[model samples]
Target chain A: MLDTYKKYFRFLVKYRGMFVLFVLMLTVLGVINAINPYFYKLFVEALPEKNYQTILNILILYVGVNLLETGIDVIVYLLGDAVILRAARDVRERVFKKIQDLDFAYHMTNSSGSLISVLKRGDLAYFGMFHELNGLYRILVHLILMLVMFGAINGQIAWLMGASFVISAIASKYLLAYNLTTRKAFNKQEDNVSAVIVDNLINYETVKYFGKEVKEQRRLSKAFVLWIKTLWGFANSFRLIDIVIGLISAAGLWVVLHRTFTLYMSDVIQFSDFILILGFVTSF
Target chain B: MLDTYKKYFRFLVKYRGMFVLFVLMLTVLGVINAINPYFYKLFVEALPEKNYQTILNILILYVGVNLLETGIDVIVYLLGDAVILRAARDVRERVFKKIQDLDFAYHMTNSSGSLISVLKRGDLAYFGMFHELNGLYRILVHLILMLVMFGAINGQIAWLMGASFVISAIASKYLLAYNLTTRKAFNKQEDNVSAVIVDNLINYETVKYFGKEVKEQRRLSKAFVLWIKTLWGFANSFRLIDIVIGLISAAGLWVVLHRTFTLYMSDVIQFSDFILILGFVTSF
Candidate 1:
């Protein structure tokens, strides 16, 4: 099953050109996203300096960069879908067809909700995984640029920022994984509700013959109550992740800023450079 | 269904005493967690000044706070279980007893995995929700303290930080909701699979009588193929969340840090004071 990743990739191999182009577009978009903030610094520096020509140039470049980013992003978005949708649909088709060939007993033992969740998420998951890989690649580009900028300002600060980002990223991964366990537990219960409703529906004749309509209702309601609870569990895990990320981001923000703050105080960097560094890092 | 929240709270009414105590413990724990980092700032400040006595005092208080935190956490852990288990068991007992009075058809209609999953997560969900609420409360408290400290350092910086956190939290909420919609779609497929399997099992005799064993196997296999796809969706959504958080956190981290960087450059803050602010914000 783990190797299914390879299978998915192979299935998507035909879209490799699109995927590559998507990556290239994302890189360009990222460069633009990072650089756009520089306008703030440039505008500020020029405002007091009364450098009309500089401001005009900055305005033109800002518009130019935005246009470029928008164009690249549009293509990246389309190519992402092309790569993911085509592969996912292909995989789904193959698997579902295989299921059509399966026996009844196999369907009986397998849970419908679980199966559907697996199937429905297939294409999106493939798409998401590809998108995530591309996103990470863009972030890497952002990160490297950030590091280089920090290093330019102060090597010590760059080292600290790099360490902080890496360490936080790793730690957050483990934390997110832990939360995943709880999410899975909730998902299992959700599948159960599907199973119960399904099993009940399949035995409609038996239920009717036994005159157990009221009882079936009670059973279904009971499952629903539990389903609601598990649903909340699933929802709350996202909130926890949000909180965790908030804390981690705060930590990372603190580490890098504090270093730069110290450097600024020591007169290592001027106010303009500080603004530039600040703008650049924020681009990340 | 919305009343379910009221019902859960009403069910937990008996544990009100425990809940209040839990909050108190958490508030204390939150305070300790927030203040613990200040020891470093204190130590750093005192070190440069050769204030050995202050450093010793900070160390002693640090250890003492940690010890207090640990002790409180243990009790909180116990109270958490007591509160959640009592509520969940009460609910389960009520539901299961109802199942006992149900007709045989009712029992037959319900799938075991679905039933067990509901029962298993009931207690945990109850626990997780309560934990999440408590955590959010603690975060709120931490956030207030952070904002206050920032205000103390520089009101403008504090405002920007608060704004960044709020804006990002809101943005992330919408982003997550979009992902949840996709997640729910996969959940639907999972339910279908559960239904397929459970329905087949209930009509086991029908399949046997028809000598349609091969067909039954095919049917089940068909359901499984769908299940695999949904599983991928579920997996991919989590990955998407990871990527989104990575990007959003970067954005938030950037806004706040950049502001502080400018503050330092303008001589609004000293190097030591800068470190202190950095240490404090990270506690959030």
Candidate 2:
């Protein structure tokens, strides 16, 4: 997998311009998003004070910022989509070409499904390494910037948020790894089920003529039941991860809220600052 | 497409128990979500009085509800996954059996690649239709429930939300349809590029022995250029759609904000109600 990712990255560098544009657009969008909470804070503060002019300005700014961010997001998505589609197409074409050049003995020894699986995997790996990893990198960059901004506002609060994020990240990584394992198992089980189903359906006439439909159905059902059990296991595991993450997020919010209240009561934070913290925490 | 959907629906219905359970779970989830805002409204109303106990109770209730929903979601996902895996396995087995029993004349008329494509399309269609349509239906159902909840809370505001949702839905549908067409075109162009790549690579040794490397490179470059051009077109089209949809969503949010401010200024809505309204608008 690591080697596949490395190779895919090299392939994508051949069309660096498109990817650079994608990254640039994402950076712009991230900056805009990071700035949005401040605008909301300003707008909320202006609203209660009956500062009509300030309210109007803030509203316009909010809309303008959102529109700008949306435009950047659109461009970023398109660039990423183009890069991935092209990469997948190119890689798949190369795989087909490779297969065609392989010796006859290689062809005879390998199942067509296995070859197709290889091509599909190659295509998927390319997409993940280029499109997904790039997106992940962009998000990480933006997250760090946001954390810096939060730290500037209140270092203690930022520390709390950062800790929560780190914990969640670690938990998510473990969950994802587990999910990957289960997903692979589920996929294999599904493949078996498909093999069985297809066998029965295509040989329906043969089975019926042989008066073996009942026997075939029983065999298929047995495989299907096992598939169901595997699927249930996968879903239950994912559910636990999701629930834990949600609880962690809620706990983080509670801590932030308590800190906000404490700071406000101690006259260390203004209402506007509290609102800003709330907006940032909620949105992030 | 309608026929395809019908066929897929029939296939799903063949596993009626699982299908019904899936729908029921979604409906229950939708109903619960529809009612959740009211609880928030009640909780927020009690907050200003320094009602920590009620707030804590609400928090606990919120967590409990969320966990319950997650539990149901997992079960539904598991059930659906089981059904689909079984269906896929059945189909693939049937296809394999068919391939084994197929006459020589049939193989002669159809290239292995073409047959593979057919089997692939069938398998994908089976799984895609099952999973994608289920998701689409769930969204539609959730939207309806949201509408009902919004209408119950405030009819005029609900109408405004409905209008924005309609516009967004229309824009989304149009953009998706356009993207699908462009995607299909891009696929065809990529297929042609793949064909050319395969032809050249398979005869690479022949071309090298005949000192035709430069000619082959030129030919490959021609195909590559066409592929790139097609990619650019797809990118441009997708970008246009993304921009349009993003703008629509922004506009929708703007309308919601305006309605929220109007209700708040008129003193007809509490903060909790406002929060609920925000949730509904965002959900749309």
The weakest ten consecutive residues by lDDT in model 2 chain A span A111-120
Complex DockQ per candidate: 0.05, 0.25
Write one digit per residue (lDDT tens) for candidate 2, span A1-284.
57856777776776799978877877777777667557545654566665556755665676677788777787778777767766766676556555545665675564444444344445555656665676677667666876786687678888888888888899988888888788777666665654554444334457656776557656766776777677767766787786778778767767766776566556676655765665566456
Off by over 4 Å in 2: A1-4, A33-40, A93-108, A138-142, A182-240, A243-284, B30-47, B91-107, B172-174, B187-237, B266-276, B282-284
- Tens digit per residue, CA lDDT, model 2, B98-186: 56565555655544433443565577668777767777777777777777766776787778767877887888787877777776776
lDDT of 1 by residue, B147-253 (tens): 88778878887888788777767866876677767766665554555455444445555756687657755665676576656655655565555555545544555
For every candidate, C-alpha RMSD to the true structure in Å: 10.3, 5.4
True contacts kept of each: 0.00, 0.25
Residue B11, candidate 1: Cα error in Å is 19
